[model samples]
Target: MRRFILIFLIVILCTFPAFAQENYCKDKEPWKEWDKLVQKYPHNMDIQMLHAVRIGFCKKIEDSTITFEVASDAFNHLHETVYKKDMAVKVREVLDEARDSV
Candidate 1:
């Protein structure tokens, strides 16, 4: 009975991190839209950085508000620059609305 309880507790502890991470990017309204943008523009560095910021999952240096490291070499080769420019403008507007809604 004691061994059964110990195994059950260990299994529960192991699954906790998976449950916690499953919702890592669903906290804000902008994040929901941003996830779609990530799929649409999979190679845009700016959009990727915004996603990282929303998830709190990027490396940063001191005294820097606009500089950080993304965890991919693909960020170096950017695509959809002109198209994502329009999407970015709309995202900013929606972000402001989300902020006000909260």
Candidate 2:
């Protein structure tokens, strides 16, 4: 009986991380779609802005410790182009919000 209980406890502990990750992914599902859109329209400022906002929203919803690494990459891409100054500013604002949330 003691061995059975120990095995059951070990199994439950091992499954906990998977269960938590599943819930995290469910909460982050919308962000995943936004990421896909960003990939599809790599140069579209509007889509990038949407993606940044979604990242911020996901950060808020998940109360995650994660930072806006992907958003930072997009911001860097936009920053490289002189023509996208205004759009870069907008994306930067959203990324800042996401960073602050973390």
Candidate 3:
């Protein structure tokens, strides 16, 4: 019985990371759709902001240490290209939240 329990615990521990990665991959699936939308509407600030946020989210899930730089770059691009100051502020807020999640 002790041996069986030990074997079961080992299996559970080994499988946990796989399950987490599967969910991570599933969560990341939306980025592909977002990419398509960005391609379709390159000038759309909303879509671009969402894409940047998704990029941050995926990076955070994969590795928190590397998310800040990439997310910052995306936010900077949005701020530079997006014409409306108010919209740029909102995009910055979204990027902040994404970075905070990491």
lDDT: which candidate is best? 3
Q: On a 0 to 1 TM-score scale, where does candidate 3 land against the true structure?
A: 0.36
**TM-score sort, best first:** 3, 2, 1
TM-score versus the correct structure, for each prediction: 0.29, 0.31, 0.36
Supply the global lDDT for candidate 2: 0.50
lDDT of 1 by residue, 1-102 (tens): 323333433453345345343433334654565577678667766556655644443233233432333322122222233235545666888899999999
Score candidate 3 by lDDT: 0.53
RMSD of 3: 18.5
- Supply candidate 1's per-residue lDDT for 7: 43
Writing each residue's lDDT as its tens digit, candidate 2 over 1-102 gives: 323333433453344345444333354654565566567668866457645654564465467554345433443354334234544665888899999999
The lowest-lDDT stretch of 10 consecutive residues in candidate 1 is 70-79
Model 2 TM: 0.31
How accurate locally, in lDDT, is each candidate? 0.46, 0.50, 0.53
| Candidate 1 ranges beyond 4 A from true positions | 1-28, 57-102
| Global lDDT of model 1 | 0.46
> In candidate 1, which residue pairs get closer than 3 Å at backbone N, Cα or C atoms, i.e. clash?
none
